[model samples]
Target: MKILIIDDEAKAQSLLKKLIADLSLKVDQLFTANNLLEGIDIIKKEAPKIVFLDIEMPEYSGLEILDHIDLEQYPFKIIFTTAYQQYATEAFKLSAVDYLLKPIDPDELEIAINKALKIIEQNRLSSQIKSLQNALNELKVKKIALEVPHGIIFAEPDEILYFEADGMYTNVILKDQRKRLICKPLKHFVEQLSQNKFFFKPHRSYLINLNYMTEFIKKDGDYILLDNTIHIPISRSRKDDFTALLRETFL
Candidate 1:
């Protein structure tokens, strides 16, 4: 794997470089840049698989490097390394992507490398549909908070089984078959979740989980069955769109 480090601190880079070598990491290539522009140049030139991005830099920051995103250009994994503690939560909210505080931790570097490796493996494995998958992955919603009968529970994107519109409320059904009532209305939830996962509103009252869908067949008049018997009637307005999505995912 090719790795790029973008930091102005020479000592920090040197220490990280030594750790990279000491760990005997599987880095096929390594590139270094002192600032965001230089980093962007290296990224475009080398096309490294992993980036050690710094949040703060002269002129431009790491996020500014992505000011005008060309989605096709970003196949790399980013493990943010920074002295700033303020940005950790923001990075995590972006995804489950890892962040390392300076001075860097050797174990954290190892873990980040492992995570990047797994992603690389997935990239190779899904090469056929990578373009589509990556686009969808970017659309994945951030952490969703739900209000349960007891207080509130956080819902990660992956934990969702499906969502159902219950009158004014939206129920988020988790993978464990547990249901949590979202504080927002169904329309609000739908707009917020309009990315990533293969969720579709086949019916006005239901947003079916494309991942959990065992089967989608006609059952009980005009109703569509999510599985063998979980029926959700298709709304006329959304029927065509839902059908196309299902076709794109399956066929």
Candidate 2:
């Protein structure tokens, strides 16, 4: 696969290179650009199969390139490399395979790569482009899963209320008064799940299902409740972000 790195950060660029090298993945070639203009130039020349794009730069932003680029003209799959927590929806809008948060984890990188491969192999260029746009607009689908005694207890994605971390376990709360214990860590699933505007991370330990949210409460700290029944704590670090995301998705 041919890949392009579009970022202003030298460290980030090198890190991605190291990741590919470490994995010994088959990449025919990799082209790097310091800014969007150079990135676009390389895109035209290389016509890479995948683009690893960073959102913030002095010369240009990731979204701007997405807005300007022609889907048919450049048929590469997109994988968003961002430091911001807020661009999850934006990534999906570009039909991005997955969003890699900064200080990128190797596990997260692996998951993103898997998702990207599936999207490109199964979808047409137009669909890929439209999905990316959908991320900026509104997420099309809400996927909810439940876990029982064994493993991932199958439940409709739409039936979930919220997710809360109980020590190491993440609970998938359903509207029908049942809570499913997801075996995997919340962070692990979040990286793999498709982008959804309604599903907001109110706290590091909690991933809220917006479909069930009925009230937002702010006091000494920030926290949210679903249907006025399920209460989840919002850590101090994520309080401001939680509020902002709530406003963006609901208000």
Candidate 3:
């Protein structure tokens, strides 16, 4: 991942760089620009994934970045770094952008980086979906692309037993007992696979393929047993509806 820091103050630039290193972020290239123009040049040339832009600059303030570049055309994540508190309101007006106060907190910086990574991953996932659709049309088979840090994996929807939510990522459990970690939330997969009749959300964090369900146990608490023998809870609110649907479909 490429990161560009656009701040005139040398100290601020160094501090941010140090903090990023300390946090152990996966930044492949870290570029520093003393002004917004230089930053824009680097952005056009290098195309950094995340940019730490300072709102207060020598000539062109970071806010002017909106005027300089067509953000809609080149969608890179930006996190505004400024000492002044007043600019926070304006910075948030831009969608999915984060604003951090100067003398940045390590925790906040880490959080902002995570948010940026998620958004970048989402963009990649979107592209992969488009590619998947085209490939499916040509191949005449149903498949989805799972994004990992290394590359993409194409898998059949029926091969996926379930999806488990893990913090900012999701764990995809396959029918063969292989578990693959993807850099996207479970909600994304739920929405992407909503049209498929086999997958159902049994709980907030789980989307299970009904074909893999072996048993629905309701002894002490409601839960489900899958083909791979993993027991996952069924949400109380969804219990009645889920049971009714299971009966209607299977029994």
Global lDDT of model 1: 0.76
The runs of at least 3 residues in candidate 1 whose Cα sits more than 4 Å from the true structure, single-residue gaps closed, are: 93-96, 129-251
How far out, in Å, is residue 251 in model 2?
Answer: 63
How far residue 19's Cα lies from its native spot in candidate 2, in Å, is: 0.8
lDDT of 3 by residue, 1-251 (tens): 89999999999999999999998777799999999999999999988889999999888988888888877677799999999999887888766369999889999999999999998899899999999998777564477789988999999988999999999999998888999999999998998887777788989999999998889898878999998479989999999889788888888
lDDT of 2: 0.77
Q: Of 1 and 3, which scores higher on TM-score?
A: 3
What does candidate 1's lDDT look like per residue over 128-196, in tens digits? 588778767665555766776678777777778778887877888777777777766778767767775
Every model's TM-score: 0.49, 0.48, 0.54
Whichever of 1 and 3 has more lDDT, that candidate is 3
The ten-residue window of minimal lDDT in model 2 covers 136-145
List the candidate 3 regions with Cα displacement exceeding 4 Å: 137-251
